[model samples]
Target: MAAHEMIADDLLAPAASADPHRVLATLREQDPVHWSATHRAWLVTRYDDVAAALGNKALSSDRVRPLLEARKSHDASASDRIRELLSEWMVVTDPPAHTRLRRLAGRAFKQQQISAMGERIERLVDSLLDEFVAGGHTDLIAHVAYPLPATVIAEMLGAPAGDRDRFRHWSDELALVAFGTGGQARPDRHERALRGLEELFDYLRSLVELRRTQPGDDMLSAMMVDDSSGEMLTEDELVGMCALLLFAGHETTTNSIANGVLALLEHPEQLALLRREPETITTAVEELLRFDGPIKVLNRWVVEDFDLRGRSIRSGERVYLVIAAANRDPARFAEPDRPDLSRNPNPHIAFGRGIHACIGAQLARLETRIALAEVVERLPGLRLDDGRPEWKASLASRSLTELTVAHDAAR
Candidate 1:
């Protein structure tokens, strides 16, 4: 790849080995808004540029429409179920629809409601830790990180406890189809994703029906009745909302916990600082998120012609906001690469910005704070068993395939 060539072309290559930060920093300095021939979208890298683009009105978040349209050309029938599932996702819709969905779901994620789960979360954390603490070695992802949030979200959604593992499997397959790296043209992967979605929808529909006949004190039951304004989610909307919450609820937090722990292990000083002053765990969680958050890239489609970084971006074009790169921009963060537990005034868009920001942000933070606190406190002399941890081959979210660690057997 030549120096002047668009970086997206190389980034999309399966074997591209250049560090992502170096490539993004090069682009941020030379061409912050260069159009990519490979992705057919503009790549936004700088912190300010990415943040601004996230809130730009001209950029739309209605990603499902394009996929549905493309799939209509071949196998239109298959697209129906997928569309029904994705169209109701709050993250992929524009205003009015987005506003309504956010309003309905946002009520359940209020800080007070999330805080109430603290005791429940702590008990869950303790139960999970008990399973692996004695073994002295375990895959944190499977034993703790994945199950903690999966179980929490499952209980909140009133899903059967026995089905948590199956739900996780479906979530994994859908993630590949919905947010996998490379382009959106893989037939085999999409077929698997559609099948997963079908099965998930079937299960959720039954759960919703059960809640209708035999209402329980769960979020699903709470969302069934109308609000004071007499607005209630339709059957399709309810199912879609449940599906989105079930998958997104655990996926990002699972990665966040894994990534946060890895970041601390890599920087022993930061970990030591966190150990000495446990009160800093709150700020430490923020720093961990800033240092190595789960999400890597976010997509927004241009709704109208606009000037960005002195370049004209045409309508119908897509833009990839490299959030991971932006978080490490030196201009915005001093020593952007270093993990400082008490770094004050740290403003990172890890959960995103604007109207479409993650609604479950508070819940995720609470879970991470509790999980990290317990792990660091209970498990002494913890260290990575594998020298080289594996990262998932994904562009949507930065995740570990597995994270095995060992600690003192006495603990």
Candidate 2:
């Protein structure tokens, strides 16, 4: 490897991007943590190193500055600027602010609170899947990916049932804009995403006022009674948090469900095994997440100088954990590339680990398990229909933009 490396172009274009397993495996085998000028971040491919980075709070998720520097190296582009604007959502915030906001939001996503919504999620998934049967041809992502989490988060936010489609549209734009293609921020797409977020905030702003006057079962009501000082979230924080949950909640799970289904279809033996033993659903879900996780990698900017993998990473430097790669690390699991539900003690960071572990993982697991099981049970001879699937043009959020599948009815 040269001292100054040219980031591979296969990585630049989403469709042309290297198969994540191959890239991760190569990095783990050679450079566990190597700085690539292309991405402008120290990419950590090894499991131990990736975990260490994810667990380090000293490394902030507030990435505006690092992104700024990365932009300087390039001639500048739409995608780069687009990423800069998406720094508002809580997912990008660092503590004590991140801690404060996450704690407040946790009130709404408590295990009991999230669990209580399961039956409704089941109904939502089953009802939509019912449509797939009647239509006989459906893009699982368009039909299911965008809906389940959209409806789930909307219900939690107390958004109007009529606005579900609108919410989905906005959420999709926001998700894409935030995770838009590599190099130079994509301005147009970024604006489009933020515009949707602005609209969502307007809706939530009014809802916040209403909650103040007359609280309801919605999470908005809970956020009003801030744990600290027993005061409600400031109007800005309230809107920011709402934007975060509605957007992040939907974005994270959508990819997992889409990616997980793709994995199941690709691995016929495991899919059949899952159908034979429904009890293995949980393990199967974990395997799918481990096999092809939703949140591929996490970003971090070093706040203080520290030694990482024998390399002298200075303050204000960038470090990224290639989670997708770590999950497939051979040392971490046997036959690392193989998707085996029988693989025990499979602890992978599909939802992430430590402070930022996905709060809604349990819900995501349930949504994925039920939706996948229903597909396997309902869609007969369901297999990848197209010669190749088209991947979303995003390095951060790995997903299929279109997955054509062949299917028949089970008589």
Candidate 3:
């Protein structure tokens, strides 16, 4: 690779965040285990390498511990509350702790329970669509994508419908830290996230207490029970679980719907095919996830020395697994750039792989399936506005800041 290509390969650069596919493609071909000076981490861009790294036991997922340890001399005291809460998040843990949390949280998202919510999800989608269609044009992310899953997850936790906006605000603030967004390292963003987490945790703690006294037929209530293992989550653990579910449950699903819609609008032929053959919605959702999935990158800390593609990674080093790039690797998918809604046997890792795979994968699929079907069928002449859509500059997920589309509302 040339000197300029290396200079342009900064993952944290504004241009790269808007659309990393180009840079990722170059790295995938030239240097599969490229070390990014800007990020000070190893970039794993190949399909096989990223896949193996995700399942690699040597690469630990406890990101919080390392982050706090590095900042211990500076402001670990300031971040104490948030760090404690974040360490409890299942996505940030490894091994026995993650295993226990997964076992307990798994009860809330059983296949039967998720399937039973189909009718309710459909109703929610229709209701949201009805309100947005009143206007000739609207931001799809705000009207549909964000609300559908936000409402579903909130309702599942038995949270009062009225408090949706509050938690949504909290989630948004906390996401600045959870997802690797621009300026995330700044003290203000960290402070805002800390405040948001504090408030949200307090709210969830109270909700858990209520459920403890009078259990209801909801996820929160279900989580409070002791299963075959006879292990129930402690009060703090339950609060942390609720916070993680409420945040993760909606953030990824929101981007999935928005990104899927933009991809379809960009590829008219594929959109028309889906409209003509609605039965392919299931397959379409899978393809959409592959073509332009929401999650872009995931990071892991090396706990033991490992070698890949002739590159040696030492212990305590950071590795970034580029999911978006891996999904489009030519070795894995044919015509990787194009969107083919009917593509089958598509084994995309949009929801990730391994034991830490998204716990709410089924629910996200169900919501996106229903939302896409309704949007395509109801909104005739649905097309992008003249203004170019804005993409969020984040390494954690590929998401739109907003997606405005015009449609034939009269129809």
Candidate 4:
């Protein structure tokens, strides 16, 4: 709608980043599978199309070339950088290889493993809330949401807990790199971001290598020490996956917690609804994700000619699935706009759908639930000081920049 949101074509689409559903809904009604010359692809807004694209194993997530196309076929070097930085993670990988890497990550975050961390996660949430209690008021993002997920990632990766604070800095900056913050479309800031990422990878490699010899009770250890595989893992793959996990897992959940807090504070009816009916936490989390989803959009390159609802797309064509918009699809959710915490069959694509569904979704749910429950219980009358929340812009990921609030001042 505005000049800046015009960047919504950047994949992250900041213009639509703040309440993008409005724009997406219009697309769903008009073009359903309309092509946005801005994004240089077919923008899939309808729930069915978004679900189809997400489930279409044929549509590849690795879109370095499409990015070049989006850039008006400018520089081959930029194409390489986009492919190189994105190719390592499972998000950017394809088929058989993606399966294996996902399995490896799955082995590390196996349900059994995540289930065991329940108490630890609860304690972590409590400790974070303790700071809010001590400080009277806290910037939920800085003090809690941001740090907790980063800490969980460090633990998962077997990094020292003490480094969690600095890890937050690295993750935040790295996310800016992902979003190309400051409009770093060229080499300058882009190269620096990659360099910083390499440094992070270097640090993770050291730990991964150590786990090769002296193992710990962490995820990196699980991968390195997996006896079932009877094969050693590659360092590049390991670092890539970990870096992705940090960016994907940490930031998304951080945003979820921060955004969820703001939503709950503003919606006292929902806040009391959760407290009086704690069982609603599960459904409430789903609504929170829909109301303020962490991951707003997912992109894909349609490999083969495909039929999206009715619109047609040719091979090698690109498509963008507006998840935030689809979640509010009127056909899918009655009064799609309304944030009904108790909405049943909340079938939302917020965590995405199909093969690339967020691997850390359960972890995100655990983190957000714990954080919100703790905040509500500890901070009385926890409400947003500002009516409007500031959102972050990026190539991927959607979240609040800050969540200032005032409470009962209970120490």
Considering every candidate listed, which one attains the maximal TM-score?
Answer: 3
TM-score computed on alpha carbons, candidate 3: 0.95
Q: Compared with the true structure, what per-residue lDDT tens digits does model 1 show for residues 1-411?
A: 655463444453443221456666777777878787766678888999999988899999998778577667776766766776687689899998899888877765552387789999999999889887865547998889988887888788888889888877767666755555422456676677788888888889999999999988788888887876888889888888888887677778998899998888888888899899999999999999988888888988899899986889989888899898899999999999889999988899999999998888888999999999988987888889978687755667777878898887574
By TM-score, rank the candidates, best first.
3, 1, 2, 4
TM-score quality measure for candidate 1: 0.92
Cα lDDT tens digits for candidate 2, 295-344? 67777888888887688888887777788888888878889888998777
> Which sections of candidate 4 miss by over 4 Å?
1-15, 64-85, 179-188, 226-232
Q: Is candidate 2 or candidate 3 better by TM-score?
A: 3
Off by over 4 Å in 1: 1-3, 6-9, 12-19, 71-80, 181-187
lDDT of 3: 0.85
Candidate 3 residue lDDT tens string, 104-181: 899766723898899999999988898898744489999999878778877898887888888778778778664575
Estimate TM-scores for all models: 0.92, 0.90, 0.95, 0.89
Where does the lowest 10-residue lDDT sum fall in candidate 4?
2-11
**240: Cα error in model 2, Å:** 0.8
> What TM-score should be assigned to candidate 2?
0.90
Cα-based lDDT for every prediction: 0.81, 0.73, 0.85, 0.74
lDDT of 4 by residue, 132-198 (tens): 7787655777788878998988887778767777677778657645343333454555455666676
Q: Evaluate residue 230 in candidate 2 and report its C-alpha lDDT on the 0 to 100 scale.
A: 76
Order the numbered candidates by lDDT, best leading: 3, 1, 4, 2
